[model samples]
Target chain A: MPNNRVVNKTKTVTDVMEEQTTVAPEATPAEEVIVDTAPAEMRYDTVDIDLTQSSETMLYSEVIDMGTSPDNYVGKIIKVHGQYMFFHDEMSENSYPTVVVLDATKCCATGLVFELEGDAGYPQEDQEFTVTGALDYPSSEDCPFPILKNAVITTE
Target chain B: MDKLAEYLQYPFVRYALIVGVLIALCSSLLGVPLVLKRFSFIGDGLSHVAFGAMCIATVLKLSNNMLLIMPVTIIGAVLILRTGTNTKIKGDAIIAMISVAALAFGYLIMNFSNTPNLAGDVCTTLFGSTSILTLSRADVWLCIIMSVLVLVIFVLFYHRIFAVTFDENFARATGMDTEKYNLLIAIITAVIIVLAMNLVGSLLISALIIFPAISAMRLFHNYFKVTVFSAIFAVICAFSGIIISILAGTPVGSTIVGVNVLAFAVCWSIGKLRGTAA
Candidate 1:
């Protein structure tokens, strides 16, 4: 029975080899094609800011701290699912979009401002959305909040 | 109504409602026995212990503060119950001592320690300022599981609890283990108080436990009726309080307690009117 099984395996391998030989030549050239250059800005689809399971309040706090600190979270991808908020700066007359993350108790909130890549219309205030972007600490006087640059927003 | 609907869309808000309701139910379940047994202040005492444990957990940067808080509170509960009978110091005095000490120590730790947002932390811990709205899904699950356990235990031992509460000497004389039941009550109360601290803060936990029981007592004569009414009243107050706090941007814990106070007032007035009519 073992010998018959081995023989059957060999026959299958041979059949596969024969089929591959016919297809290899056609597939080889296509497979050999290489990219000429890498893109300038690295695009990240999403970095899950999970708040549903595990220790979310602690994790959110850590994310807020990391985003605010002088450390280079710049260009690092982040995906946060949280409540959307907007701060209208009366002084600069500029509107800043922020995503607020609440702790387990909901008493404290950490607000993260994000800059959308294009002119995607801002979501309604206090709506929960999943936002993905590269972290940026803009030194501009008008807006000094930790921001997600080139962000994509989607309803949760 | 539109704004309420909008807020409900947020997962955190929904989570708060679930946890708040569960915590309210558990607290009210234990509240009846605690009030009847004259252990009303025990919830407040145990909550302070939990608060101290929370402060320590924070200082040590524990991932889940409940780990430290639960065991400490259970231990505190056991000690309080055990010492209630024989201690030279009265039970209320002992509870007050422990409660104040824990609060003071917790504050001291928060103040001297390198804990960030000390004022905010203290405020939230003591008054439950919007903490209910910040519940994670994990917290909701924990609250659900614990609340279920509490309810099951209460149901399973309902008669024993009633017997012990009304006439402990008679219960002990009738071959029932009064001490064991008392211990169980203390442990359950501690657990409920600890869970309730997140909803109403340490200072207001007694109100969470006491108000429902007392309000139900004002209207109901039978123990079962009172217990049922307390649970219903607690749930309604908790639900309404959470919604009001979310809409009005008030402190979640205090608002719930405020609702409880209002319920108590209404019950008191009803009882008075009924008494006069009778």
Candidate 2:
């Protein structure tokens, strides 16, 4: 053996890649999301609030004597807690935007201004809807608030 | 001859026969155009409106003055027809509104009123049973004369009526006032309704208007042929229904309506089969 040549074998990554490849996993069925945070005791009150407020207006708590009294609002624009400002309307404590009193009007009762909503149109609360209607005066004792008449919606 | 002798024995029975034939003729004749025009629902609506008027009359304790119901019913029929022609509210809507409202008003009057037998009386008028069998001589004569008047008018205005029924627009284009013709039809229909209320009762009389026309339509294609055929068919059904009711002791209105429905179904089936065969 006059010239014993040294044999050299080089292994390349591409040569072994075709035999072993990664497979993506199949998609799983989507699950429904649930969000229920309101307590059981105040459910009826929330419902009342939702019933009173118009579907167009948002609910806001009126601070009387620093949270001693929470007044419901509808159709009137008001500021809430320095962060959010919306139309304050009466809604039940349980239901969102539930209109407690669909109609109401402002009157001085026992040295405090009370808004009595009239019962012309049923307005739900916590829903965003723009109402272009006129203010109505008290025509009945049951509801003592101004009403929106010939109201057109800009958005819901 | 024996049956005729029997039917003629009671003056009231004679009256029923005379009144029934007249009503069947009048209704069948006018009903031809109405059915052709596809305004058949008018009969039902007008009848219900007439029923409402009858209820009102009942509440007021108008016994002999029950004839007051006719004018009110006619007025209501005219109103329904006019409103039905409006572009804003369709004919079907007007028919539905008038019928439901009239029935509702009748119910309200019956329920709220402190009158005895008012509800029963209204129910009788509505279903059309109690009125027909007990028709007096005067009612029978009135029905006959009214029917004759209606028939004469239809004969006189045959061409215009046909034109209006076929194509109202073309009728108007040909210098025939379609609105007048339509109003005439409504008025005639109202009068017919009041008359038929005495024969078939208000609730079941519409079948008399609709069935004979439908049966005739199946047998004949031409307008004149259909009208004649419808009258004949109506007479047969009326007589047969009465005879069956007498024999079976069933309600007259139900018997009549049942016979008409059966006849219509048979005719319709035959027509359908013939069409398929052709």
Candidate 3:
């Protein structure tokens, strides 16, 4: 009689286990774990300034050509070493950071404008610095050259 | 050193080395006969023709500029070589006329043809500012094929070339077709000139063709020894020049020519020392 009672208790326990397994999933409302799918800010810690290693005159020429055909360099992360200068527009009272690259002969020069994110301190006029950023063609009416967006500057 | 190793990994640098070495080899091979036959300036003339043709090609917006450049340069070579002796206009004079004319015409066309970055285009064309580094894969392959063809032709017809270079009239009297050999030389010269334009530009192509042979001649009298030495010297100079230019961020064509000039100077000094000792 004690053996029969033990068997009956065992059967009841198994039945309870099956009921829990079957109803547990349906009992919960199927909670959706929503994940944030927004893209992270594209930023680079270090950018290699290969222009210092490349042919200076040719690099200058290439940069000028890129200015003419902005479509070729859009979305490319570029690092170039050049003199840093700021142009203050009298009409708009806006100061723009420009990097001036001189050719090998130093007779010719080309300039590329850049935008910095944080307070990187104002670099001196004609200060040699390496700028790294993504190349962008701004839709601004006054800007004719391609720009470096979200730039990081380093002294050469 | 590490930077150079890294730079070499780039496809453009590899292409530059391949084309540069091949062009140097071909130019030096042809340089031997051209120097001996008093046709050293023909390289300059043909390169000028190539520059002019390139301008025309650019104006016409041709997909492949070599198509126009090759035929025009070949024709210029033929005219320069064929009419050299028969016409009142001497060879050097004709070459000068054509070279200057082509240069002037090319500049004029580029200036007025609405070509963007006119200065940059002219600078690259005239001085070869990284043109070797900017070559496409198709160009590199073409350069390789042409260089091999040039090498094979030089090796196969070495004896005939020597005879023609030494004495064309004697070669003709000896039942050899001197005109045919001259025509062959002209064609090869035109091709080399075209190929070399990327390495040293139109203004410096003559240096690429002349310096090695001249330096080799200073050290060796025999045609075979001179040709071999010229090829070696040209290759070394080209390699060193490219490396130095890359490291120093200097102009590639001028750097190669400067290396050639230095080699010539050293060879001249060595030749003088040997002459004095003897």
Candidate 4:
């Protein structure tokens, strides 16, 4: 018989299957999904630019070079070094951490705005930091500059 | 130094040095006339107007801020320079009012924005910043073109510029278009001030146009010598300042201005020794 039934072998009607959740229940524990937890090199996006080794001021210049052509940096893991500032301007609202380099006047600062990979506690602001992340652009209205997403930050 | 060589290898560092040098040369040359005419306040007033225009450009989310900053500053310079006794406000009064108003308005507009780096923006606009190190290829080209144009105009009309600076009435009597020259200088001044905002920022920009001119005046008596010397002097100050800032992490604008001040002192001392000091 075509329908020789085993313990949960009844095939649902094609019409009914289309309306249900596509993921079928797995009977075996081995069928559980595992998240990809690879190292940065093992991941699809490779570290293209590593600024961690650069001197503090050189890092600022390199960041500016990256800022000029943000589109070219997409999905590329860039490691930048700078003084970190916790971007919790409106404490009640969501915010990202920033690594900053002052402008020519030494008054204004421009840097990579970064969203962390997980809900990790941030360090004290204004410390030297080396942040690694994939380049991401925000909506023009939100920020005119490019930001780093899924970033991992380290501090000295 | 090894550190200097390391920094120089980067393209951005080279760009900063070029722009800094060009700006030094142009501003120093023009600064002689402006300082002699007691019109150095024009630099400050025009720079403030530039800051206001920059704020508007930011609020509008314009891709290139120069589009707005350039025209507005030019217009302000013309009004401040050309509108002689016709306006109720005197030239100095107009400059004072406009500079203060524009600075206040700029601050007001910026305060209303949701920019995350509000303090940084204001400080960068008001004080000098380190943005010189971060210029794009396009910005570098624009600076080069503007510097070349300014240099060519100055070279072609060197004699006339000297004549006009000394006596407007005499220049007019000699069938020279003094008003036109004044307008040209005003527009140029406006452009230079705006460009300088990228160097010393809006507040300290006057140093570029004022210091080298005054310093060179102390060292040289002839107009041609003063012009040449100021250009050379400004370039040295700017060049050394940039290197020092890069090596030691000092504020670029202030360091350049400080170097100019130091140069002025040295020049003044030499002038005193030569009995040129009045």
Candidate 5:
């Protein structure tokens, strides 16, 4: 695979923690190695852990409602599951990832695009986050998609 | 007489029908040149600009008068025209910038407001509820009058408008003030969009503008015929879409948009078949 690593100038505590664990891959099991980077004050409860077929473990958020639209949670939350229609995002390399529109309503958002705000020490495909962020409504004659203006991926 | 009596029995439904037909006619007429120019996205942009304006008004607890939306949207339209005319930065970039900025600003305004039910109203605006099914007779007359105004403008300006849209350079060389003409048309388009947004809501207004135009374009080659056919098509789709939504218990705006998309798809396929046959 090509190295498309993007450097972070403003590395958060989470980024620093992920970097530390990345070096000790051989000695520890995946769950024990992947520590939550949030300070204990900010860290919410660790509800449960589940591994998909690809063997990536996801920590569930108690507040993340998978049944609801995840657009508003762009900057505030992470790793939320929802019933977003499965469409091949023309812009992304990921073929089967769920697409969340800015409006949360399916019809209102046509083509808004987003990238996960931070790396979650896991594969991009496994790191599904429900984030709350600023939103941009469709304004131009050509732009069909509405976007969550600036999604800050806090936790997934 | 029976139709009139039926409407009298339910004033709101009658109002909705009459208002709906007038809007359908106006949208269909304006939609022809819009489709020809392939600027259908303007309708989408205009509706969103309207959304942003309403969001701000809601946040400020301003009188939810349609007039407040007008000034904001006119500024937005002017900005779009200015940025688009430069043609140095891709039009898409300007659109992207304005769209994101407008939406973000709208949200911030709404979030900070202390109004009662502000968020709920915002949601209603975004999804576009049709409580207009219960609009009073005066409101219906207002809508009808606006629609007529739009229709009359189109009729009067059809020649100059056609000249400008078909070939601006040619029109300019022929001593026509293309820039002035284009500006007037844009203003008209902006007003029409605002009216459409008021009647059907932002979510479905673009569908009303574009679907009939697309259907007519596929079926007819003459501009006049296309406009007439599209008006008829819009009325049918709008009326039927309302009926279908009422029957199916679905979101009215979404259902109408869905109907428009279906019409477009069917018409497109037929056009494809005809092309193959020829």
Candidate 6:
């Protein structure tokens, strides 16, 4: 609820193209809403682990760990800042929303996959933003990487 | 200091620092003997060979290139150290030939490769290293094991290596198998060179191997004293370099080497004042 961007509605990647026109924020379905429905134990009731507080090197290193060492991060309330990216895989017919953090060299990249809450509008590609959520692996077969579930996106 | 403490809590950062120290200790340990024997250029030559081997491994899409790289570099080191003296081509000439050839051939291979980030891949492997902080758990373990092996061998044969290093013909006349000791030094140097390729990139690895020994030699008179001082100086410079780079966002290889250069200057100044510099 703090600096959160109100989304138009629940628009999955497949339907995102058809609904290109910006529509007014509409009432979202109960099942689609994550912030309100996600268990209060992790995201809602607790203060998130703030990643933006650290330097870029520290932040990038931690993000790399989430991939190499996943169990340590799962189900934890987390907050991070990075450039937003959207990937469309034609062979798998899947679209993934991700945030990328750059290392000191600015050559190598470390990224985190994020899933927005229901009714959240998609941010523009490569836009810098802060996202907070509980780290989880969803049931979707398209993305094998751990994604931030019930996430709230705040664009700078 | 506070910022470094905060960064140190992360596992990856800790891993990087640990590997950095171990690799520095190993390289500095080998640095004294190499510099004394005039085999300092061997580190650079073998590193270029490693780059070529790595490029080949990259082209083949091997999951881990260490398997291909380690043996190739070892063979190259043995060949150079053993045959350089006996052959007409000679030590420096043969090393120079292999060095330039491997580097050019590696770049050419990389130019034709299908890697998505060709420039980035080559750049990371050529200059200040980016792989040190991004290493997997297996890399850390392997580095530790290899470093321990090098240290153990160095400690066990310290006397023999010292004899062969200071005066090879005298050592041979004294009934020591000089060639066997030379071979041991070559193998150990090759291992450190390969590990340093990850820490400082292939191009700058010689700095890691030679700078500390040279710096220590500026002040110390005895071989034992110089070797100990070099090892200590290298560890301090390298560890501080990592901490500074993490806080300052500088490249790791250059930062470590920069610290070494600064330390060398300071030692040289001290030696000049004492009238002891060689």
Name the candidate that leads on TM-score: 6
In candidate 1 the C-alpha lDDT for residue B114 amounts to 72
Tens digits of per-residue lDDT for model 4, A1-156: 112211222322332223222332232122221112223333225577776655444556677777776665777788776776544335333334578765434445558877655432233456566667888877655444678877665544
Over A27-75, each residue of candidate 6 has an lDDT whose tens digit, in order, gives 2233443222223233456634567776665677678787777777789
TM-score of 6: 0.86
Fraction of real interface contacts that model 5 preserves: 0.00
- State how far residue A98 of model 2 sits from its true place (Å): 64
Candidate lDDT values, in order? 0.75, 0.58, 0.77, 0.76, 0.56, 0.80
Among these predictions, the greatest lDDT belongs to: 6
Off by over 4 Å in 3: A1-43, A48-77, A83-129, A134-149, A153-156, B276-278
Task: Report per-prediction Cα RMSD to one decimal.
Answer: 17.9, 28.4, 18.5, 10.7, 17.1, 5.5
Kindly report the docking quality category of candidate 6: acceptable
Output the better candidate (4/6) by DockQ. 6
Return whichever of 1 and 3 wins on DockQ.
Answer: 3
lDDT of 2 by residue, B1-278 (tens): 55335444544555666777778888899889998888899999988888788777767778764478778778877787788777699888988898889988887876666654454456567665434656655777777788889999999999999999999998888898898989999899999988888766677778889989988788678899889988988888888776665444455677778988998888788878777211
The TM-scores of all predictions, comma-separated, are: 0.69, 0.61, 0.76, 0.77, 0.60, 0.86
Greater-DockQ candidate between 2 and 6: 6
Residue pairs in collision within model 3:
none
TM-score-better candidate, 2 vs 5: 2
Per-residue CA lDDT of model 1 for B1-278, tens digit only, reads 87567557656678888999999999998999999999999998999988898898888888998999999999999988888777898789889888899988987887766754687788788887666655666887998999999999999999999999999999999999999999999999988888888788888989889999999999988899999999999999999998877666566787899999998999999988888211
Query: Interface RMSD for each candidate model?
Result: 8.1, 30.1, 4.1, 3.1, 14.7, 2.1
Q: Arrange candidates by TM-score, highest first: which order?
A: 6, 4, 3, 1, 2, 5
Higher-lDDT candidate among 2 and 4?
A: 4
**Tens-digit lDDT track for model 5 on B64-138?**
457788777777766676678876875556666766776677777777876544554665566554434545556
Computed on C-alphas against the true complex, the DockQ of each candidate is 0.04, 0.00, 0.13, 0.29, 0.01, 0.33
Off by over 4 Å in 2: A1-156, B1-7, B112-114, B276-278
What share of the reference contacts is kept in model 1?
0.04
